[model samples]
Target: MKSLETKAKEELRKAKSDIFSLEYQNKKVWVKKARGTFSSALHKFYYKVFPFEVLIPVETKTGKETIAFETAKLDLFREKGILSPKVLFKNDEFFILEDCGKNVNSYIRKRDITQEKMYYYLNLLIVQLALIHNNGLFHGGAQARNFTYKEGVIYAIDLEDSFTNIPLEVLQFRDVLLFLLSLTKTRASFDLDYNYIIEKYIELTNKKELKQSLKKLANKISFLIYLSQIKLINSFLGRDVKGFFKLFIILKKL
Candidate 1:
């Protein structure tokens, strides 16, 4: 019997293929069979982000096995009180997690993102992030598509690159930027001064008095906004497709 960790490592092969291959028609989905090289961490990401069809169970000639939902990692996340897609199935070396119901990105792309409703949801998103980080984990890849909303509440997903010792400053900068970036895509890019939208949320959410959070949010993006054209590039969809690789290459030497 293969341990769940072993099966998860095996599934990580070709993470990008699975992410792009997930097909959703109405509420049903068909996921591609894993057949390429993707890091185990990223495979964990795909499983958390999307629901998939039941495929043949994977068993090695040596008698190792893979199963869904019952994996140790899933249990760990659930036990921590973190919000993610609910697990649906598990059989040797495979698992299916729930879908977002509706994407958070779609809501951000709307015309009137500065509406009070938008601010309310965004602040709620921020509080959820604060709570998750307090539990000793930070979602390294904080982006709009990672958050989801259904009914009147917000849910977070994906936990592959989290850090247990995340600095409060870093977490504040990261979470604030993600929320701001969503607004930028919808409004700020048009020269609308949307800082008030953020300020209002901060005012309403009676937490640990987020003054430092507010300050860092500005400082982090000061350079990006000055060179907004450059910082504005989509992390996933770059002009060169692999343009981020070149940017990272430049960054590594500096």
Candidate 2:
């Protein structure tokens, strides 16, 4: 019988997608490959033009460097007591992670899940995000899609974003905004009380600068908020703009 490492290597050679799942040791694991050079470059460029002080983009890497960076981030998150996927196997070309479970987005869209249960899961996510920020760390992509839920615990995944050369408070503030924005994309957003969610986060987080950052961001985007209310602009931009307007209105009150 071939070792799991050997099987993984063989699978990698035949793999077409950058990320996929494989069975190993009678359990499912996920394999991730580095982005191509062009894709990595474009990622860097997108961040370069991002119009916020909170998102200070770093140089993006590809191939072996990308794999190494992500692996290091996973290890760091574990060290900080944040729940993340355990790296079962890794190398320059690719790495494999123990299966966590379905993302919160899927749960939000499930028709059978009660509103109370959905709120419970959302609270878990918010608490976990608070814990991560309180630990002097920030999730670069703190979206619902990047989080997994299993056995009543939410695990943060997609730990590829780098927080280098950025203020910790700024990065953490960005994480909060990204998380709230992601919730707007879900069907449950309509039923959610934006004020309650924001207040809960404020109550849990010890970051004194967070409210200040929120105030600053709200002022900076006041024009965008006004435009988002316009029927013409809202139609073109969709629910995202409306969601932002709603969330920022609550933030502005803080």
Candidate 3:
């Protein structure tokens, strides 16, 4: 039997997908390939169109740079006491991460999951986000699907973004917005109290700048909420808009 590291190297040589899972040493790990040129370009294009200061996007890296960037991020988060997958192996074209567990989105979507259980995980996610912010770091992608639950711990993943010369508060503010936006994608969105989530986050961190950033963004985008009332707007986007508005309202109050 080959060692897991050797197996990973062999698998990376033939892997086609951008990401996949492998089993070795009785443990599962994820292998990720660097983003291709076209995909990297497309990602950068989207950010160019949106150019919000609080939402400033990091330049998309490709090839070996992508592997290096994410590996550094995972290490940074771990150093800051935030939970993230341990990087098992890395090279120019590919990297491997220990399987954290079921994605938080999938866990919440489980048919047997109760509302109470859902809130429990959601709260944990928020707490983790707060801790990240408090440490002066931010998750460039804070979506529910980018988080995983394992053994009573929630781990952050998909950290492919990096920033330079940006205020820490701005990055942290974007994290809060991304997290709020993600909640709208789930069935639990309708049942959740957006104000409570905002309040909980605020309670966990002393970052006054983050609260002010949310307030400023909410005021600027308040007009878009009216569009959600339009009949033609699809249910999914409408929920997201409404959820964003609710979070904004809570921020304004704070």
Candidate 4:
């Protein structure tokens, strides 16, 4: 077995690859390049069953483009005094980064976090995302899985999906929606109120527009859930039904 650093360097030299992961100095790092496409068995199965292209998130840029984009994004976060990973080395094919720590999902799952602690952590994530949006940027995939906690601080990661092509308003609302959806999915039992989370985000950003957009989006999603519940539409639009009802419960509260 090669050292993690050696593997990382080797992967960077490859012409084409899908995902590369290795550990260096007791820290884990990885790269995701397009070596064809990857999807879960569930996703593939559903596509065959439905045979319709759903409007899904796309990464049009190659791994090289993503590396440069994320590198610049990291610099921007640091300049704005936000906590995130630091780039150790980068090139067109891939980049090496300082592993921040366990993602929020892993941390929460590994320990029994108190309700108070959970609220604190969630609020911190919302505020950090709010800060990023307030600075006129958006993390395309704003989920707990993309956030890390270490040494009493939360760090954002998986920024290759960050983008600025859309209007800031749309992206801001999208950021909140994506986050709440991800949060609800992680919590198998709908034990948390998403409204308070959005309220906190609105408070941090002081953006009344975000509050309005959030309400509209929540209501729209809630209606879809209603349709699914009525069998008028397929759960997850014929995709994953694992958390559809849970998401409905979440949106209703919102």
Candidate 5:
């Protein structure tokens, strides 16, 4: 007479042996069995700016209860009314989530995006983030890959890594900074308006400090850009100096 929870745990253990339970439309659903150590918060920032995933260690969870912990976190986001995947099923190994929609990258690839449209979508993404932070939550991974859009609404995904470990203010600002960095990847060549985006986010949240936070971040980015210009520092940091300068230019324009 095992309880339903117990049964689910048993299924999760079995799932580790056979990773993928289903697959379709180039999207594979499986329990990623290998658990690795978590990255430091600093590396999370580098992850947005650098192409060093090849050298990064896998996320190795120290215990078997990791999946359960992740499942609970996803449930909390849904309860908070944040747009994210709904848990369809769960166990200790992995949980099946309802497909929210196409991720931002896929949605943008469908056609040539006008600068106006890019700005509009970027503004919407930031607004959604404001809503999440307003609810006292922080999306640890705020890159475009972790977000999807459908029917005029944006949804966040990959809650397993989302957390509240840092202060709400720091986390909120990191989310903003990371998201802006992500847009640089997509629309690097476009003459985008960073000021409008930041202003609108501050307006939506009514957080005056957001503007200050962004200013400080812009300064730090500018420093990085200068370092990137140094040949020795550039080689040591493995930074795309041009990319750093580009991002700094965008932020400075704000």
Candidate 6:
């Protein structure tokens, strides 16, 4: 096989192609250009060491545009003992992460897919989330897509809006909201069999606690908190922004 450097260079070139390519995971990823300054020499240097990159994520892990941010989430994943792609490179402008393949969203949406397999993947995700929360780190983005499954393993991805800073609530909301978006963005309108999702989510979590948490979350916010909360709930239910905004506007009209 080619030397590791040669392999990475080959990978980097692939990363730079098109808006981006999804060769890292199954349809997982590495990363491409920084949004604004990538064309600049200094920004490239700066992003080289950044921890995560803002992205235009698509059917693959990355998207047409991306921005890099510096953080220790890579190490956090390693330290917390979560399954993830390794971060092989970093700079002010970009950081290279291991490729996790097509996410659980696709798998879950595949219809009539086995519950045993889905639960197996979800169990991994829940365990990882529990561990991260215990350590004061938040996934910031948790959803089916952020995880990749191959053979029988799961890998977590995306962390541009992430933080280890927390009362745990911050992390919780971020992960919950983003995951909902992953479903919203990736699946079709009719693709979501929401009750099925709730069944799965409930399987991995304590339904009583989740219900109580939702009540608490809404109570602490404005009277319209239910609407905002629905943003996440609908997303998990596979309802997209198009549908969500329409519903939000209707509720506001009410």
Scored by TM-score, the top model is 2
- RMSD in angstroms between candidate 2 and the native structure over all alpha carbons: 2.8
Query: Taking the candidates one at a time, how many backbone clashes does each contain?
Result: 11, 0, 0, 0, 6, 20
Show model 4 residue runs off by greater than 4 Å: 1-7, 10-59, 109-113, 162-165, 188-190, 221-223, 228-254
Ranking by TM-score: 2, 3, 4, 5, 6, 1
Candidate 4, residues 148-173: lDDT per residue as tens digits?
A: 88877888887766433556676667
Q: Which ranges in model 2 have alpha carbons more than 4 Å from their true place? A: 36-50, 109-113, 235-237
C-alpha positional error of residue 247 in candidate 2 after TM-score superposition, expressed in Å:
2.3
Each model's lDDT: 0.47, 0.79, 0.78, 0.66, 0.62, 0.50
Per-residue lDDT over 1-254 for candidate 1, one digit per residue giving the tens place of the 0 to 100 score: 65443444455475654332232333442222322222355555653554211111112221112222123444565688866666544444345455655667677666666656566666667666665666655544456667778887666754333223445555544554555444445431233234454454455444344544445434433554334335445444543333323332222222
When sorted by lDDT, best at the front, the candidate numbers are: 2, 3, 4, 5, 6, 1
Looking at model 3, residue 22 earns an lDDT score of 94
Tens-place lDDT digits, model 5, residues 1-254: 65434544566666646333344344434333324247677777776665332113225454345556556767887898887766666644445666666778664433468766776667768878888888887776677777888788898876545332445676667777767666555533454466777788888888887666555556755666666668876566532345446666666555
The predicted structure with the larger TM-score, 1 or 4, is 4
Residue 78 CA error for candidate 3 (Å)?
A: 1.8
Top candidate on lDDT is 2
What would the per-residue lDDT of candidate 6 be over residues 1-254, giving only the tens digit for each residue? 45434444566665635224434323344653433312335444554644212221211122222333322566667767876767665554455665666677787655555656555665665665555555666665676766777667777666544232245654564465455445444333243333344344555444435444433433433344355457566455434545444333332332
lDDT of 6: 0.50
Whichever of 3 and 4 has more TM-score, that candidate is 3
**What's the lDDT for residue 248 in model 3?**
62
Cα deviation of 190, candidate 2, in Å: 3.0
State every prediction's TM-score relative to the real structure: 0.50, 0.86, 0.83, 0.73, 0.70, 0.54
Q: In lDDT terms, how accurate is model 3?
A: 0.78
Query: Against the correct fold, how does model 4 do in TM-score?
Result: 0.73
The window of 10 residues in a row where model 1 has the poorest summed lDDT is 54-63
In candidate 3, list every pair of residues with a backbone clash.
none
Q: What is the C-alpha RMSD of each candidate to the true structure, in Å?
A: 11.9, 2.8, 3.2, 5.9, 6.7, 9.9
